[model samples]
Target: MSTTTYPRRHLGQGDLAVSAIGLGCMGMSDFYGAAEDERSLAVLNHALDIGINFFDTADMYGVGSNERLLAPVLKARRDEVVIATKFGNVRAEDGTFVRVDGRPEYVRSACDASLLRLGLDHVDLYYQHRVDRTVPIEETVGAMAELVKAGKVRYLGLSEASPATIRRAAAVHPIAALQTEYSLWTRDVEAEILPTCRELGIGLVPYSPLGRGFLAGAMRSADVLDANDWRRQNPRFQGDNMVRNLALADAVKALATQHGATPAQLALAWLLNRGPDIVPIPGTRQIARLDENAAAATLGLDAAVLQQLDQLLAEHPVAGDRYPAAGMAMVNG
Candidate 1:
């Protein structure tokens, strides 16, 4: 239902380009809360209708079910869309994420399986969802580079990789992007990882750019999440931390009102203003919400507005760690 067409942004140093805001498809099949297949498909179609072609999913999302879910639309429009998915984060039979695996054999098999599920011959972008410290990054990325040579993947990326790991990976292959948890609330990457990506000419793809929907004005407290919601286990959404973070959301909402935009738009607009090399993948199931997010591509924030927003976050300082202790151990590997 968007009346305006979207603008495109280049993801890496390559010719690879996508809508300014890509669609993060993980929520359609896993995480967040309960989801209906019909609703998810509707949202996917709506995204395309509104000019979103960069779709992100992971092999572990729903234990390979996410890629299966996107197969139909992708098969129909393979040439029109850019498919980006990740491997690593080994899952057990019972669906628990056990560890990261970057072995060459696993990388090959994972890419093959993901391609089969997506009904595609080659993915536009393939990423190592997490770095496996046990395996040398050189060994891992050397294998990933083979996929590109074999015509299985066009570009490579890494998520939550440390700056040193990024350099090591890029030594083997060009890392088109570094998808990490980055937003108004989670700015730790700015201190190091972001600048490294800039120097390396790798694009910054910020996942959870709306702070897992908190900055989108969707969550006010832990009580608002479904009982089975993953956010319930996340530190930022629990108890006292939730209350403190609500104030951050309130400040964003206030700025949103002043700009005549929704909180989601304001949050995403701020990211868009960060640099041309940055693109945020904000996921949602509702068509209206997708339209609102897409509109953010055109919502310009001036230096004064950006400064005010930054000041508010500096004064308030987000309350909890971005992830739980166990989850925290895996990032920036």
Candidate 2:
């Protein structure tokens, strides 16, 4: 939401609607670097005030610190926005490593834990953060459908799930959205996932739409990353891969200049151009940067310019995989 509503995008199936752009809350608590809770809370409030009704978070993000962080900000306006939280990535109480779990009993308990963390009896949308291959998708989604029937969750989602698994889960219950890594560099979704979602009327929620801050032109070098920064562990951002990828970023920056848009805006605009039903969620803990990202809706792109971008990006494909070895090991697709 902005001075204007940006626009409404169909999320899953019949009757569901959300802003053209959503807010990814993962970085507000952990992963990217140390988070500024005070500033992050302000950003969340600002998002709601601007009409950004779709707010995304996960159970493992901060091991529930993210939901707890949203407690103060969402307490008064809980009903105004679509609060989407995820489960499946289980953590030990010590807050160390997490593993995927889609056991039926675990699903119920995890949802309950998320509810307690958010201080809400029911979540607007609940997603399985990752597919647990050991547990059938039917079992996981069946447990999720029960939550809907029991009034604990309004809608369901799956993150990084394969198209086949998505269809299998949809057989249990209609999935409102599929959250996945989707950016210019991460184009694998276009070949299978996006088409399957379109055919089934499931909305595509693009996470890391800014290339995880790479498309923003803020990260110029691997050396710019703090020692603890997760990107440093990413192959695409390591060693020569780091310098090689900047050429692609430079192309995006050039296109942004010609279009009178920021590289971040160009990146988001590119995703929005992919389909009307797609919503790009870029995470930010700074209010000014949040506003800038939201403003991407105002910067539109026509067909010819979009094709030009496609060709340029195609010519200068990014180097490195989107995730590190351990992280890549969990993605369903």
Candidate 3:
């Protein structure tokens, strides 16, 4: 169990409570660049020490390497932490995403494999990483509900699903949370998806709340990214888009200075103020950066500052789609 209890947020309708600011463990294994296991483990341990109990991972994160990386850490503190991992978004042995698979048999096998990797009997929350359009939402969620019924999972969630699909899934089972890319610049959910979640009483877990570290004003251009960095392929970090997006980052930096906080803190504070039903999981590989993200839970953004930040985002409207063309095809399903 954790020595320090962090502030909590409830997902969906049940009594499931997790820390308001969770740690997204994606970067610890893959995507951004190569990861040092020693450094990642330290960051994970520090997250628990500082009261971040909710840890997010996915099978495809490192083609299962990410879950393996988290296994030892979660095994030691099984009772204290809530481990959330996703299936679907299938990937090949080479780590290239192939297609989404929501077949009932695949679901069963995936959960079992994930449990093996995490060294846990049950996962706290399980999400369908992406909606498999070929399979009906009801069928997919039905298979997930079985995991809950059998004690393999405690709660169910969907990532990047459309409002209609969410409604359908909720009809089959109580959807706990919707994990989607939501940040200062990514507000597409606000129009319909967010309000729909509110009506259904489902909580929102905003992934990349710092705009993939862009809103922190630390990244100036795509040139700054290592050749292997995934952000290099992201549209918003490319050529002209990179130039325009940095302006948005500059605005956040300006607000951060006025509010006596780092740009990352200001960005997360804005998300926390959006509603109590929202939880933002900001990932970091560095121990110092982890503390900075956890501190955002305590940074309060008042109405005026929020308004200024809102206007800044509205005026700039960001430069490109949150993902590349192929990745974009998988979202809002």
Q: Which candidate is the best by lDDT?
A: 3
Q: What TM-score fits each model?
A: 0.98, 0.97, 0.99
Per-residue error for 2 in candidate 3, Å, reads 2.7
Candidate 2 residue lDDT tens string, 1-333: 235455678788866677788899999888888888888888888988887878999999988999998877678877667889999988876777767899999999999999999989898889999999899999999999999999999999999999899999998899999999999888999999999999998999999998889989878887777687788888988888888888888888998899898999989988988888899889998988888888887788998889988898888888888887778888863
Q: Pick the candidate with the highest TM-score.
A: 3
Please tell me which model should have the higher TM-score, number 2 or number 3: 3
Query: lDDT scores for all predictions?
Result: 0.90, 0.87, 0.92
Lowest summed lDDT over 10 consecutive residues: which window, candidate 1? 1-10
Off by over 4 Å in 2: 1-4
lDDT of 3 by residue, 1-333 (tens): 568867899999999899999999999888898789999999999999989999999999989999999999987888778999999989999987788998988899999999999999999999999999999999999999999999999999999999999999999999999999999989999999999999999999999999999998988768867778999899998899988988899988988998799999999989999999999999999999999989899998888998898799888879899988888999999
Q: Can you give the lDDT of residue 8 in candidate 1?
A: 94
- Give residue 280's lDDT in candidate 2 (0 to 100): 89
Kindly report which residue stretches of model 1 are placed more than 4 angstroms away from their true locations once superposed. Answer: 1-4
Q: Is candidate 1 or candidate 3 better by lDDT?
A: 3
